[model samples]
Target chain A: MINDVWILATASLVAISCALVGVFLILRRQALMGDAISHSVLLGIVLAFLISESRSLPVMLAGAVIIGLITAWLSDTLHKVGKLQSDASIGIVFTLFFAIGVILISLYAGQVDLDQECVLYGEIAFVPFDTIIWGSSEQGLDIGPRAFWMISVVFVIVLASILVAFNRLQTVAFHPSLALSLGINVVFWHYFLMTLVSLTTVASFDAVGAILVVALLVIPASSAYLLASTLKNMLWLAVIYAQSAVLIGYALAYALDSAISASIAVTSGVLLGLTILGLQVHKIRLRRQGKATLLEKA
Target chain B: MQEWNLIQQPGTWELLIEFWSFEDMNALWVLMGSILLGMSASVIGGFAFLRKRSLIGDALAHAALPGVMMAFLLFQTRDPLVMFLGALTSSFIGFFLIDWLPKNTKIKPDTALAITLSFFFALGLMLLSHIQGLQVENKSGLDKILFGQAAAMTQQDITLLAYVTVFILVAVTAFFQKFRLIAFSAIYARSLGVPVALYELLLALLIVMSVVVGLQLVGVVLMAAVLLTPIAAARFWSDQLTTILFLSAFFGALSALISTQISYLAPAMPTGPWMVVSLASLFLLSLLFAPSRGLIKRYWQQRQLRQKVSEENVLRTLYKLYERRQFEQNDFNIADIQALRSMPTDMLKDTLKHLCKKQMIRESMRGFCLSKEGLEIATQLTRRHRLWENYLNQYMDLPADQVHSQAERIEHILTQEQEWQLEAELKNRKSDPHGNPIPENTEGMSRDK
Candidate 1:
């Protein structure tokens, strides 16, 4: 029971952090940029491991953040300077970086502890095994799973950043030129959000892997975007949706004995589908009410 | 050190030789299969790229995963055909979801693509992990479809790959014109009474087939690269659709050859990444070095245009100075030239030197003077500038102040025929909107007197 709580906490932290940053990405039409950064961060992790000669968490995080920034910068450059289509540039940059990451892992398979499978779909099931012990030796306390701790810190950082810079991020996301006109630094906000995405991605890597991080980032925020009219409501709704997905997905994964992260992603998609259907039904009912009111007046 | 040992192995040379010699039947099959896959994927990917749906291929490839898992669970077999059908059905469903979500919901297309891709991939992962826990035979190689193990491809895999790729190629060839029509402009094709929806379905089916067959070689993660990079690279080399298609196929085949050779030589290296890395390299090369549209070529063209514009500006400035002096003196010093127009000293010197080298200007004790050829050219430029100014001020109803900058850019590119037409249209105007006298076209006339 405690293990399941830890797993749920870890998954919820991941979903919350990703969904918070993902709201800005979807608003800016940069959802795929989130996707690109997640894939390419694998190369950063591997390179950091190779360079630092250790799998220390900070070094890997630093490596992933740097590569994530570069992935964002390079794809933007390719679209602007190289004159490639934005989608094609995004595709090329991430795939090349990912290919390099895969090749390096295979080349130094013995030296590096990471593998392609682990990077693709992380072993979230093993999160409970890697615990962080806190306090003194005799009465040492288990501080839940290491992934939970990492993601908790990330979730706090992401939430605080969003709260602190809510208006700036909103203006930059919705109307960049207007933000610029109002003396806001659009580029600074862009990289600020990208850094948060990178940090969230690297932290969440243990729970959800790289590619599915995109699922967590995009799905809940998009669902919130459909229902919420304001940025604040969207943020709140997305977190709520993400938490619901975690709970339901955990139950589903437990019953099916399947991967928890994938189940969460699938659950979020189902929620979005349901949101779309409900909205459609609501629209139809309103139209019917309008017709009945006209007939009564006549 | 491990890499060094792999390279230094004595058998490496023989393996390369054997690979090229086709002595190993497995090597031959892998090579043939990759070549066909490369060609066919690039050809179909060209259409997707043209339609601005490059990443949809990525989504569909990921969407194929669950279908493959479902097929395995039901049939309890690893037959390529069953897996292909399962993947095909699921990918088509994914294709429709991607198409349907944006139209039916408030979700933008990019978000829709992201949702469909990741959701389906996650569901597939769930099924795959479930399958892994089962005690089934032939389940060991099931995970290979994620990253693709080219070396483990059996003859049956090769045959399936060959058949699917060939069918895709032939179908694409048979419907080339129709496909091209829809890809370029679907609304126009619809207006022409073309069944655009049917053709779009056909294209989607072809794309799904190529993507499914390629799962064993390029895998789901990087399959989109095989479908996109070659066509992107080929686009830099040509503008014609047929030429682009041919070039993209050629590039695809070439990358496949290079990657397959490397994979065969180094057993640990996977074919998919090598193939994608090589294709990316080719794309970078084409982006940098292809003629006309390549970055280097475009940069050079811009540089040349800058030089020409600056050079012409200097000549025109000198002519203006000469005209201001009532044609009394052709010789004007650098200081006199600078008084009329602002040019940096170094660039002015270089422009003067270039003009001298072209024999358009002559240096004397006073400073510089236009040679006969230079005077004629300057006269023609001045004439074109003034004529454009007059035309814009008259026909465009500009207030004369806005005409100079517009005339400045147009003077550089206005052809001789355009000059004649402008002169005729303006009825041989002698002065511009600014009341500056327009010089007559002095071609074939002696001005030395």
Candidate 2:
């Protein structure tokens, strides 16, 4: 029972952190950037593991940030210098990086802490087993779940960054030239948001793998963007939506005997579909009411 | 002992010999299959690249996964044909959703693609996990589809891939012109009374077919790279669509040959990444070194143009110096020329040396002098410069002084024919408005008396 509690908490924390960064991505119309970063970070993990000979969090996160920045920079260069289409550049760079990661993992299969399977769909059920103790066995501190702690730290950092630079991020996303005119350092904010995304994606990888992290990062914020009118409201709504997906998806996964991460993605997708349908229905009702009022007044 | 045996196993050279001798027919079949896959994918993918729908191949690949898992769950079989049909059905549906969503909804195309891709992939993951829970025989290896093992490809799989490759190639050939029309401009094709919508759907269908066939080898995640990278690299080599298509196929085939060989030698290495890495290497090579559009070529051209412009500027300056002396003096100090154009002394020296090598300029007792041929070239440069300045002043209505700076850059680029056109257009004007004489085009040592 406690293990299930830890799992739910870890998954929810992961979902919330992803949704927080995803709001900016949706506003910037860079929804696929998360997808690109998440996949290429696998290479980072394998390389870090190879070099450090350990599965420590800081080393993995450091490697992930480096590769994530490279993916972003390389894609931008390909678009500007190579004159390739923006989307094609993104597709090529990420896939090439990801393929390299896969090759490395397979070639040094036993030497690394990862397998190809776990990289694709992570083993989140094993989260509770890997505990981080704070002291001796006689009087030790059980830190709950390592994934939970990692997601918590990532969530705090992302939230604080957003709160601290909310205006700059908003101006940069909506009007980069205006941000520049306002002396906002628009490029710095752009990389700032990307840093948060890389950090959140790597932290969440232990719980949801790389592919489903793309889902967690994109779906909720996109759904909220469709419904909410303001940026602040969208952020809140996305968090709520993501948290609801986690709870409901956990239950659904329990009932159906399916993967928890996949279930969460399915729930998010279904909710988005419902929101689309509901918005359409609301517009139709408003139109009918407007027509009746006009006829009666006439 | 076990580790020792593993380390003592046959090395790469031995494996290469075996691969060449065809001692392992499996390797031969895998190689042949990859070659066909490469050729057909790149040919069909050309249209996708041109239309800027490169990522659509990615979405289709992801969307096909659910159908493959569904087929397996239903039939309890791993028949390639069954999986192919299932993947095709889902891919078509996905293509439709990606096409239809943006047209009908507030959601943009990229968002729609992301949603559809993740939605279907999530479904596939769900089903796959269920299959895992069932503990059925052979369920252990089903995860291999995610990253694809070429060694796992059977003889039947290769045969199926061959037939699909032939079908895709023939279809693309038959509809080549129509595909080209839609890819270039759908609205224009519609204005021409072509069935644009039908051809668009046909092209999407072709993308789906190629993506599905290559899925087992390249897997769902990286299949789009196989579909798109060859054409991207080939684009650096040619602007003509036909040549690009041909070159794309050749690159695809070549990468497949090398990657397959590597995979055969190192059984531990998977084929998909090796294929993708090889293709990416080819792309980087073309991006850096292809003759026409490569970075090195463009850089070289720019460098040559810079050198030529500076050289020409020096000769024009020498002519102006002669004019300053009222046409009596034929040589000027190097420092005087340097004062005229604020240039590096070393660059000026090299420019002077280059002119001397070409017999355009010679070192005088004071500094530098224009040779007879050099004087004629300098006269033409000065004439072109002054004429452009006059044209800009009279037609463009600019101040004569402002025109000099504008005309300075244009003088190097204007051809002799353009100079004549300028002369005629300006109605035989012999002198610029700034009171500078525009000399006639002369040869050898000839000068106006």
Candidate 3:
């Protein structure tokens, strides 16, 4: 029972990292980029595992980041030169690359430690077994699974990096021309942010499957976008929504004895649904108040 | 060693012949079905595109996921009929939410689409995992539907598609006038006693139907392409109602066949991407060589216009030289006019012929001179130039000489109302500071030029 808390904490931490990075992705309107990157990362993860003969964290991260860069670069190039629309270019790149990844997986994945089932569904249950300890000079506290450590370190880096660059990032997301005119190094920063989003996503892949990984990256931030007026407020709301969703969803899954991550995803969805419904109710109340003023004037 | 290899290897040429025959048959079926899907989607997408609701298809495709899972949960099977019905239900509700949310709430459509897309896809994932845990018999069918497996399509798919195709054809034809009028001019359509709301609802329903039918072949991600590609490809061909409809059908038919053939050839590839490739190729071809709108044709037409503009500039320069006493003789030949402008000999001769046809300039043995009509036109043009310069200098606060360069582009597009406003603003200046006379306004000057 006590160990269950650790798992929950770990899962929530993973969710938080996705939500944190998602804030900017949603603001920049790169929501579907998450979906494209998720599918394309399969090629990277497979190549990394093949070369390393194991799931080396740094190697896998590097591979996934490379795939992310490829997806972004391919989409941008097609849009610029081929004169295709942004969404169409994104669709073309992901479908073709993902098909190649599918073929590769079908041919070579048969003999490896990986399988299509792991690729699509993911396996968070087995994460606790893959572990490492660090800085345990004292007899009591030690580190846990390498994924836990990876996500923890990543969370700190993402939070600190975003905190420092918040002003510039917000400016670029809203007023790209203004940011460029003011010497924001807009091109480098865009790629830098894409890299961070890719790293955070690959880090969360072990806990959540690819599709739900996409769900986390877009939903909470979009929900916050609806509920807030300013970028600062939106980011704060997004963090709250991401964590609260994890907690509520974990409890519901525990009660129902269902999968933890899947339930949390549905809970995030339900939260957005309820927010929409609440907004409807508020509109009706406001309309009623307006009608009352008209009646008084009459 | 070569002889031994030949003996060991079976001839793939004979095998290839057999494969090609089988592929031809399969490609025909795929093409027929793609035609059905493409035509219906375009007809439906036409309304959506006209209404600027193209992204609605995208939103609804994502919205259908959870509904599909819920249908599976209820039916306990991956039956196409049940799943599609369920998907349609949730997708409609998703649109209802998206539509209702903005009117009643603070959330915009972008956020609405983003949330619904993520939420429904997430819920579907949860339901998918649940279905897996229960060890459902047709679990693999779920995976096939997600990414699309066009090869596994059997006789049943063809039959269902044929039925839907007929329904869409009859329905669109029956409502053609109403749909067209509604698409072209909504207010006019309403005034004609058309059921505007019902027409819109039916349009949305058809779009959802097209999506559900194509989901088995294109999946959630690229179904919008199936809806968009044929129309986009056909847009290059013609704008006439009949031509657009027929050409879009043809394009859809062709794209589907190519995709289906590719899927058959490469068993590993999905039908959705093959379909996209064919659609993209059609659009690329259209961009290069479509009759009216192709890049090549536009470029050629622009070259003709530039030739005319350059000729006019030279003739105007010659006219200026005559005004400055360079060509003191009242009549001069084309060769003398060409020398004054320093233009190429043959090109100037060709342009001079075109000008003589327009009656703007005429040729004598001595040189070229402006016609009486040409003088009035040139004087009007010159007056506009000086007047605009004055207007810009006074209103825009630019230097008097600096305003001349800016008016070069503005003189071409300035409307009469705008010119009048400019004249009023400049207080009807009779002469430019350059000492050029602002020609007097004359009757029929406005109509002639």
Candidate 4:
């Protein structure tokens, strides 16, 4: 039962952190950038292992963030300077990075402990086993799951960054040129948001893996985009949606005896579908009311 | 390090020799499967690349995962046909969702693609995990579909891959022109009485089929590279769709051959990543070194143009200085030329030296003078410039002052035929709008020289 709580807490923290940064991604129309970074960060992890010869968390996070930035910068350069189409540039960059990561893993299969399967779907079920104990082994206090603590730090950081730079991020995301004219560093904010995204992705890697991290980043924010009229509301609503997905998805996974992370992603997708359906129904009802009012006047 | 040591082993040569000689039937089958998969994916992917839907293959591949899992759960078998059909059905549904969401909802196409891709992939993972927990037969290799293990492929898998790939290739060839039309301009194709919607459906089906079959080799994660990079590289080599299609197929086949050979030699190295990495290398090569459109070639061409333009501008500047002297003096130093038109001292010297090397200018103690050939060329340039200025002044209603800068750029590019047309349009005007004598059209004289 305690194991279940840690899983849900870890998943919710990951979802909220991802959705917090993802709202800006949606606002900037760069949701696919989230997808691209998630994939390419695999290369960073592999490279980090190769260089450091250790599986330390800081080294992996640093490597992943740096590669994530490079992925963003390189794709942007390919789009702008190389004159490749945006989607093709993104497709080329991320796939190439992922392929290199896979190759490195295969070539160094003896040294690298990571496997392609764990990198793809992740093993969220094992979260409770990897606990962090404070103090000495004799009387150490068991804090929580290591993943839960890592994600909590990331969540606090993300929440702090958003709070501190809310208007600047909002202006840059909505009107980049106007923000530039107003003396806000658009490029800085762009990378700032990208950094937040990278941090969130790396932190969530333990629970959701790489690809499904994109599901968490894109779906909740996109659903909120459909419903919320303001960025603040969208941010809050996205967090709400992400939390609910964790709760419902955990229950679903428990009932079906399936993977929790995948179930969470599925739940988020279902929630987005329901949001779309609800909006459509609301529109039809509103149109019917308009027709009724016109007919009564006639 | 181990990989390098293995490469140095004497046994590695025998493995390479065995791979090429087809001694190992498994290697042969995997090689054939990858080659066919590469060719067909690249050929069909060209249209998607051209249509700018390069990432749709990725979405469809992810969307196929659940279908594969569902097929396994339903049939309790791993029949290639059942898996293929399951993947195709789900991929088609994904295609429809990607097509529908952007049109009907406020979600942009990229977001729609992300949503469909991740949602389906997550759902598929869910189903796959559930299958993994169940005590089912042949569920062991089901996870291989995620990253694909070519060595695990059986002969039946190869046969199924062959049929699907060949069918895709034939369909693409049979409907080449129609596909080309729709890819380039669907609205134009529709106006010409083509049933664009039906053809689009056909194209989407072909894409999904190739993507489905390719899942067992290239896998889902990097399949988009196989579909996009070859065509992107091929684009640098050619402009026409036919040439691009052939070149992309060739690249695809070549990458497949190389990757399959490497995987057969190293066994631990997967075929899919090697294939994609080799393809990306090809893309890098084409991006840098392809003849006309490649970056290096374009940079070289631009440098040459800059040299030629600067050289001509110096010649024209020297001619203008000579004109300031009422055509008596044919020579002037760098200072005199700079007085008329400013240029860097070193650049002016370089331009003058190149002109001298071309025998268009003579270097003496006084400065530089136009040779007979150079004078004739200068006369022609001046005539074209002044004639353009006159034409612009008369037809475009520009003031005399504004025409010089406009003519300055047009003079170098104005062809002889254009000069004659401009002169005729200006009605044989002798003086420019600036009241300077338009140098006589020395075309016949320059040819004589």
Candidate 5:
């Protein structure tokens, strides 16, 4: 029970971070990059582990950041120089980097147990053992694992970044050219946003891997976006959705005795589908009511 | 050791020689198929770019992943034929989901795509893992799809690629005019009795073709990149239909060649990455070097135009002041001319000298005045400005104050015929709404000029 609570807490923290970063990415139509970040994080972790010969958090995150940069750099190059559509550039760059990571894993199969399945669908069963300790065990209530600490810290970081940059971010999200005309560095803000997304993604990859990372990032944010107009409301709704998904998904997986990551992914996807349906019904009902009132006035 | 080094040690030419010696058939086949695939994808991508449906490729590519994986597990094989059919069916399904979600539900394409892509790919991942647990790994070829392993090109793949290309080409050519009309204006096309549904379906098929053809080269994840990048690169080259088609093909072929070369140089280098890099490099070059749209060309054009505008502004300002009885005598003083505007004395002197060389202005004792021809030109311009102001106020229902700015923009743009039509429409008003005299008609302002 304690172990389950610890894992549930870790999932919630990571989910919040992903949901937070996703709010703007979806608004800017850059949500797909979140999934790409998850896949490419494997490359970062592998390269970092190879260099440090240890699976430490710093080394792993350093690797993830570098891979994220490479992914972002390639996408930028494709967009600016290649003149490819932004989405196309993202699609091309991340998949290629992800493939490179796959080949690297295959080449160094002996040193690493990472496979394509693990890369695409991360295993949450092993997350509990990867604990973190700043000092003595005598200290009260250790923050569980390094992954938990990483995500909790990442959640706070993402939350702070979004809060600080929210206004400029909203302007860019709504109309990047308009933002540029206002002398705002649209590109600078965009890269900063991407950096935050990559960091949050890396923080989550240990628990959910690439595909689920997108499920966590995109679906809740999308549902929230569909239901709200204001960015502030959307962000809060997405956070709420993410936490709910984590809690519900953890409990459901516990009941089914299935792989937690995939169960969470499917549950969130279904929830998104349901939310979309629910919103539409609500809208139609409101429209009918509006018509009824108008008819009464007439 | 020489054989082991695929790129630096043994060049493509050498590889060709060795292949010919060994009678390697599969390599030749993959190369041929990739060329056909490359060409068709670019052609379709060009149209997609024009329509701004580039992201649809991103959506469809990811949507097809689960289908490919599910087919692999169910069929228990790595045959190109079955996997492609699986991909096509699934891509359509993805397309259906995108269209359906919006109409049946309120899901936007972006949100629907994101949802579908992740869900489908995750499902595929699960199926793939289950299959991976079995011995022989019947679909090991499936893993190569993520980034694409184009170098492992086989004869069978080439044949399939050729057939698909041919199939797409026939469909596109058969409805070329309809496609263009629909692409340019759907409402007009629909009103003109064109079957909007058929054309739209063709477009969806073309998008599916773009995705399915490159499954072996770029895979589901990056297929959209190949489908969009080439067209994007080509857009900078020409707006003409024929030229755009050729350039898109050129970019596509270049990407294929570069990706193939990369795969050759680095053994086990996946086809998708190589293709992406190749396409990216080609796109970059086009963006920098393409005529008219390139940064260097635009910058130079703007610089030259600025000089012309500054000169034109100085000449026009001087002539207008002379028309108001400010500087009519010979040997005009430059200081008085500078005082009329906020421009410096030296700048005003330079403008006076430039106008003198052009015989349009003469420096008088007081300041600057228009020469005979310059006076007529200035009168004509001022007359057109007020005429437009009068016309807008009387005919277009503009307020008196609003007509000045509206007429200002129109004066610089109206053609000779348009100006004459406006003159005729007002039936020769003696004075403008502002009570200024309208300029007399001149043979010089005839349609020929």
Candidate 6:
């Protein structure tokens, strides 16, 4: 039972980080860019492990950030310079990056602790065993799962960035040219937001792996985008959806003994479907009420 | 790091050579499968890219995951045909959802794509996990579809790939003109009664088929790249749709060849990413070096234009200098020429040398002089420049000052026909709005040293 709590905690933090950044991504119409960054960061993780010869958290995060920025920059270059359409450019860059990552992992299969399967589905259940220690062996304090703390830190950073830059982010997300007119550096904000996404994705990747991170990043925010009218409401609602997904996904996985990360992704998707259905129901109810009042007046 | 040295083993090169020689039957099958996958994907993907629905492949590929799992669950067999039908059905469902969502709700197409993609992928993952937990035989290989395993292609898989490839190619060829019409101008095609929506549905079906066929090799996540990138790269090579489709298919086949060889040589390396990487390499190559629309070619053309503009500016400046000197002499010092055009000394010297090489100008120890040929060419240029200035001044209603800058840009680009049109529009006036005399035509003038 305690183990489930840690798993759910870590999953919630991962969800929060992804959802916070994902709100801006969906609003800025860069949902696929999140997908691209999540995929390419695998290459970063592989390279980081290879270069550092160890799976140090900071080293992997740094590598993920650099590669994430490269993916964003290269995709932008392909769109702007190569004259490819935005979707094609994105499709080309991330797949190429991800393929390289997969190739590297396969080539150095034994040297790197990462495997193809782990890179795909992730081993979030095992995350609890990788505890962070605070002192010497004699009096070391367990601070719970390292992934939990890592994602929590990232969640806070994402929250602070959004909270501090809300207006600028909202302006940039809603209307880039308008933001530019308002003296916001559109490119800087784009990359800054991307940096946050990269950080969030890398932190979540330890718990959910590469592909499932995309689910966490896009699904909650998409549901929120459907449900909420304001960006503020959307962010809060995304957090709500993400937390609910974590808890319910944990319960489903616990019952079925399935892959926890995938279960979480599935649970969130189910939540999104329900959200869509509910929104439709609410809309129909409002229409019926409006018609009834109109008929009474008539 | 020691693992990296395996490539340097004594027989590694020999193994690569043998693999590329197609002596190995497994290698040959994988090669055939990849080639068919590439060709079909690129050809059909051409239309998808044209319609700006390139990401539909991504969504469909991801959506096919659940279908494959469902096929395995229902039939308890890894039959390629069953899986194909299942993936086709599932992706069609996904395609309709993607099509319906944006129309029915306020969700945009890209958002719709992301939603369908992640949702279906999650469902697939959930099913796969449950399947894995069930301890089913042959369950392990199903995960390979996420990243693709070319070595996993049985003879049956190859046959399936070939059939689908042939089907897609035949259908696309038969409907070539109609597909092209709908892709390029759907509203216009509809007005002409071409049944645009039916064609769109057919194209979607074709995309779903190609994606399903290629899924075994390229996998779900990167399938869209295989479909779209080759066509995008091929676009740099040609403008004609037929040529683009041909080049795209060729690029796809070529990448498949290279990726399959690498996968064969290094068994540890997966074929799909290598295929993607190879495709990207070709795309980068096309983007950089294709003759017509390539980056290098565009750069060279720009440089050529800059040189021509500079050379013409020098000629115009020389004529102005001759005019300022009251048309008394043809020779002028390089410094005086520099003072007139604000050009760097060395660059101006090179232009002068180039002109002299062409025998358009004569260079003496003291100064530079336009030969008779140069004078005639320079006179024609000056007349065009002045005529364009007058045209812009008269027709665009710009002041004389503003017209000079406008004519300065237009003079270099104006064709002979446009020059004549400007002359006629200006009623063959001898003088411009600023009252500078437009030099008359000096045909039949002989060159002099």
Q: Which pairs clash in model 6?
A: none
Flag the better candidate by TM-score, 4 or 5: 4
Question: For model 6, how does the per-residue alpha-carbon lDDT over B318-372 read when each residue is reduced to its tens digit?
Answer: 8888888899877888888878678888998888888888887788656887777
Better of 3 and 5 by TM-score: 5
Task: For residues B1-449, write the lDDT of model 2, one tens digit per residue.
Answer: 01112255668678788789998988899889889999999988888888988888888999998988888888888888988899999998888988876786677788788888888888789888988988666666566667666777888888999899989889989999888888899899999999987888788888898888888787888888888999999999999999999999998899889878876666666678888899999999999999999999999999999999999999999999998998898878888998888889999999999999998998898988999888888898888889999999998999866998888999888877787799899876779979988887774343222
Candidate 4 Cα errors over 4 Å, as ranges: A1-6, A55-58, A80-82, A128-150, A180-188, B1-10, B428-435, B443-449
Pairs of colliding residues, candidate 2: none
Q: Please give, for residues B118-151, the per-residue lDDT of candidate 1 as tens digits.
A: 9899889989888887888999878888877788
Provide DockQ values for all models, in the order shown: 0.65, 0.58, 0.22, 0.64, 0.30, 0.65
Cα displacement (Å) at residue A103, model 2: 0.6
Task: Find the candidate with the highest lDDT and give its number.
Answer: 1
| Stretch of 10 with least lDDT, candidate 2 chain A | A112-121
**Residue by residue across A1-298, what tens digits does model 3's lDDT show?**
6456666767777788888788888777777676778767777777777777778778878988899888888879866754545665665566555555554554464445555556554566666766665556556345676667777777888889888988888898888899999998988877877887778777777777565677777777767877899988988888888888888988877665566777888788788777767876987999999999999999
- Can you list the residue pairs that collide in candidate 3? B332-B366, B332-B367, B333-B366, B333-B367
DockQ of 6: 0.65
Candidates in order, TM-scores: namely 0.94, 0.94, 0.73, 0.93, 0.74, 0.93
Quote the positional error of residue A243 for candidate 4 in Å: 1.3
TM-score of 4: 0.93
Q: Candidate 3, which segments miss by more than 4 Å at Cα?
A: A1-10, A25-123, A126-154, A171-199, A202-209, A225-230, A250-260, A277-298, B1-31, B184-188, B236-245, B287-399, B410-433, B436-449
Candidate 3 is graded, for docking, as: incorrect
Q: Tens-digit lDDT track for model 6 on A68-124? A: 999999999989988888988998999899999988887877788888888777889
TM-score of candidate 1 on Cα atoms, chains taken together: 0.94
Model 3 lDDT tens row, B285-326: 886688987667878888987775665565445555566664
DockQ, structure candidate 5 = 0.30
